[model samples]
Target: MPFIPTLTLKDRLPRPFKIRWLRELMDLVDELYFEYGIVHQDIAGRNLFISDTTGSILLCDFAFSAQIGTVRHGQSVYLGEIPRCNDVKGTMFFLYYLITRDPQYSRYLLSDVDENTIMDRPKWVKHAGVELDYDVDTFYNELMAWVRKRRDSPKLAHYTLAPRHFEIPDPPEDGMEGWYLGRSHTMREMEAGRTTLSWERPPASKWDKSRKLLATGKYADERPPVRLMHVPDPKKGFPQMGMTNAALRGQDKRKQTQDVVGTEDEAEASKRRREEADE
Candidate 1:
């Protein structure tokens, strides 16, 4: 088998470059969960790879990967159904350990860390004699949001709207019976049978170009005038010294006549030279 080229995210310092890499890594994870219903289950620095040519992030080490709502051995798994696993099977805490190198923070991953415990408290880690500040609460919130979304749980919220001080919203009493599945739900579905709430108007229909133009305030109902300056016409032949089309046509005819006369003169001179040689 041919070897595939990949670069691991290990050994890279937590600078701006690595920070951007992590952001892209998270984007890849989001895409996988939302589009493919596949969870990496082992998202860490070493398991991720950056393609040398495309610069796209890749997730490897699928030993712990789980597929939701997929088929196995001719059995179809329904949507929102998850396989049971006794132990936790992800390397998310390894990401924090890589940044802080603190065992305390690593152990905190075993239990839920609330925002009250970390809002005013900032964890400090020393790297190369430089002290870096880590916001433990923000990290925990983001991690929880990511996990819940990957699992297709109804409790997942927008990243910006992730609960900071309070626990995430719980699934309905019916166990997601009427709850919309997947990463997101349409506004119509979210606001079903809600008469008190005011709904914002949806955008113009895609097929309605006039409405789109009106909405954007860039209506161009009339065609713009064409500007005629320094434009060449190949069918009229080359323009001679800024001459117009009529003048260019006259010049071309004259040039062609001159060339025909010159060819006849050359042929007559050759006949005279041959006669003289015969004499």
Candidate 2:
């Protein structure tokens, strides 16, 4: 899918079918890594696409793809194509940051940096007491090493300098990530009545209870039926900007206000403000 899609990845992640899709997805990546010596360094949600029919999945956006060093005899040689590594910067860094939760890749710090602003986070590896080349191979190798650490860890907290255990994906099964170890999804379903959904206790009707007086010329009536409000597909018929006309209009008004108040206009407004300030 495009970097930005109408449906946010967060919305798709909860559905049972989506979970299966995710498992296949990681497997697909692993397959690509081993078979093709290709590591889809950019493994974020935006890089994924879910087919509406059959709930099929796809991995796209090869703008950052590279045929890195292969896994010989089932080894994790994450060193990507060494020759053209310098060209890659954002994609691998993103994966490393997510898998490790390293603060260097924290959204708070790395969000604003651009190609012109700064180079890759070689410092990130350096800070960790590892010497790394300034290429995609180095980036991939370093990141994989970090991932292995978390894959074998107790808690998945990223380290600043040293490698720690990481949260590893359980070995793929029939190309799926089987039931999670935790009850997070099950608990969420219970809270939302998605599991073993059954009507627990019956509610008393108005006729079953003594009628009470009301202010309007109204009489006690049965409680309204519970109507389920299904959330619309996040990407479903998304508007050009995922916005309503009223919201856009409000933004337009705000821009007008900002233009009237912002720095660039101050010079012109200064004359009028000075006239008013004097008066």
Candidate 3:
């Protein structure tokens, strides 16, 4: 619930306290994802907070929770097809334009949580040959190391995310490909507060040009003071402002097709996901 606009804190802190606070909050998040099998897709600035008292940081933003095994096109599929993280924009992560599979990685890589009924694991993983009592701390350390190595990485940098004490990502086998399940189709949740909620879009929803608002006969026209512009005003406000049921009904369809066609941005995200999976 803490909005970033109202607060400011040090992104760079001393290693000792930073590591302590990070690890503590990480334990809670790891448990939630692995034990409960819930994926917190929003893992960056908007969803993070530091406690003034304990100097602890916690992850928030439940907007992207989804069930295990649910599949959508081009969404990042971490291990066992569990969601990793969502692209901050249409199909990319923040800072780096990558499709991520956060839930899958958190669930399987962390200690104790397993899809294997051997505690709850997939047969494929068992076939890959893993052992019990895996120390997740090592895994976390490695990931952190990777993040450090590629400090300025945009995406695909997660591949070497850190120096792993042990490898959690299974070796990729021939003909074994992974895919992501994008947002749920026809789900009203995907449509609500879309333009407004996004932080990546400059000026955000305030910029009427960013979104081509189909004017509803019943709706009044009142543009905000200043906003980011996404689309060119060919016909300007009056003509661009019209809306119809047909225009809205096929939103999911449009999105799916867009994923298939893949703009330069989407292509970049796909490339990042592929590299992560390959590594």
Candidate 4:
């Protein structure tokens, strides 16, 4: 096996966060579901690694990965066939946590909290003084927008299970809404003025094979051979790193909350404590 040394997105933070990178990561998720019929089942910053050399993101830790149209324990299972999942899998607040780095929000999402409770922004968000509602709304809007773009893309015509095309499941008679489920109107509205980010495919190189050999102790020398390979320029097809117009508008709308909401520092500190405890 090749020695793939990488750093999780969490470790690379404190630097500027790029919306395009997030879009690319979401694209990977869409590809896994639509093209490969695989559901990662775990989408978190810790599970996503960034290649140090290539600067491209990689999804890892597939212990919980599942496939559509598969039989498991004498039961048929199909995930992402429609909006809303029967099983609650994957890091529920991954995108929200990634953006806000707020432990409170993460904790709330991971718990068996009611959807209505979450939607009641004033009870929690206002009390915490965080613009979580705006953050979550923006994240979902962007995600749905990306899904719509990919579903309509001519290049992805081979994919039969596009998310945008997923049949919206019948609403629960119990009046409980599954926010995870996709809606056609939501997808369409998100795609109205959105543009998909471009990505360049990396060229094939011998660096991986060389790394494997070195890892297996095939070389007698203490020092491994230095190899130079072309690393794809990430900026070539990626959007510029900065906030977009929509984000700016959101910021403007939440200006009041921004002044009063200072939970970001607490969130960062909480995250650090958790990391330390784990260590």
Candidate 5:
């Protein structure tokens, strides 16, 4: 897939981001969850990118994406008996981290860090270097509002069902039961105590003077001993460079045949000359 050049949010570590960018990221995360029913379990500053051209924020790294209420590994829980880790909660923490630049709470596991704890806080204290287009409170309010709206929804929001379901097929049975060490032995051959040739690994490439020179970048200054002439193969049906359609059609049958024979002979001679030079 084609992608615009971008820098990760973490890459801008010491540099503060704008409030608008955070809001844009929030909208993108909301869309991923509510609209697409995808939970990007692994949401972090490293996964988010800022476009180099537009300076817009983009949430990425969907390797840990899962359906709303599906069960993953033991580390996380979005739904079921103990619903702990989720995108909404993750977004809240991520936004808090962006504003405050305090990674104290985020150091803990997802299930251990509670979003409500951050939400109940009186105010978010911005770091000395942290700068924003708007007041820290403004960004906080926007984030809180989104969190409230998400929390109001059903816990197990299985609204969107998969369009199609597919069962993982079993592995195909292998036909070469007696094939071992790159050698195939049929049932009859094995019963008759027949032996198969063992395959040897290819020898490592040896560095010749020319190869060493090329590897060390010394070959760039050297020119070829002989200048090569590009010989066009007529079998590929390439049009003659200077021949017009009218000129070609105007040629007599005998002359056209002679031209073809001349081209073939010249090609053969060139091949022989190349072989002799190589020898």
Candidate 6:
């Protein structure tokens, strides 16, 4: 998908914005909840974006999103029990924050906070700096009606099956073993060289970090000698050296080894060596 430049709603806060934009956001929430049968577990200022070109509200960040009625063991966030209410409640708190700029209600854990706490408030005092196209009542009334519609139509909200369902395909074989569930491979098979394997996108695990150790039976510790660009002053005499020429000569041969272990710098190696000596 082509990337479209957009700014988050939070970035544009305390500035005047159209009330219709927020209503559009509520429309998006309605579609995701009822039509798509997906629950965007996170609906907040940061996750909401206003298009730079189109001036429309765009909901992003599906990292915490899941299909409605999906329950899995070890999953921290699930929308199974309350299939359709998660996004609605989140939209309520988000709208509250947008108008009043009061984030105190949002800080509470989703499980602990009740949407009614905001809905039940007699009035929402808009911040002095904040501006909206329509009166606050217009927005609140529409939200109240949206919440009521969802609450009253429990049957529509609690549909066991979605209109559309998708299945995730199995991961293609990586040449380590045969295609079978939980099939175990020997250490030799697991480490089979990747030069023979064809991959669309190779895994970083296939890069051999310990190639020098495995081939030479000893790790490379020496770094390439630093060559000074300027000649030393004759008056001050030359600095003391520790096998500078031999270090320079072997530099070319150890280039490959250095390439593999370049991430470990000299300072870190010295610190590690000092720690080992102390031990």
List lDDT for all candidates, in order.
Answer: 0.46, 0.43, 0.37, 0.49, 0.63, 0.64
Task: Residues 38-129, candidate 5: write the lDDT tens digits.
Answer: 66776777778777767787777665666666554333454531346677777777777877767685365667777767875564888787
Candidate topping TM-score? 6
> Which runs of model 2 end up more than 4 angstroms from their true locations?
1-18, 69-279
Candidate 6 per-residue lDDT, tens place, 113-212, comes to 7776687656488878778888888888888898888768654433246565454344465555544334333434557743333334334475357543
C-alpha RMSD (angstroms) for model 6? 15.8
Comparing 4 and 6 on TM-score, the stronger one: 6
Model 6 regions lying over 4 Å from their true place: 73-85, 106-108, 121-123, 155-160, 168-279
Give the runs in model 4 whose Cα sits over 4 Å from its true position: 11-14, 73-92, 105-141, 147-279
Candidate 6 local accuracy as lDDT? 0.64
Candidate 3 residue lDDT tens string, 177-202: 56433455345554774533322433
TM-score on alpha carbons, each prediction: 0.35, 0.27, 0.28, 0.39, 0.51, 0.55
Top model number, lDDT: 6
| Selected candidate, larger TM-score, 2 vs 4 | 4
Candidates sorted by lDDT, best first: 6, 5, 4, 1, 2, 3
- Candidate 6: TM-score? 0.55
Native-to-model Cα distance after best TM-score fit, residue 41 in candidate 1, in Å: 0.9
Candidate 2 accuracy as TM-score: 0.27
Question: What range of 10 consecutive residues in model 4 has the weakest lDDT sum?
Answer: 82-91
Assess candidate 5 and give its lDDT.
0.63
Model 5, runs deviating above 4 Å: 1-5, 13-16, 71-82, 121-123, 159-279
The per-prediction CA RMSD against the true structure, in angstroms, equals: 21.8, 28.8, 28.1, 31.0, 18.1, 15.8
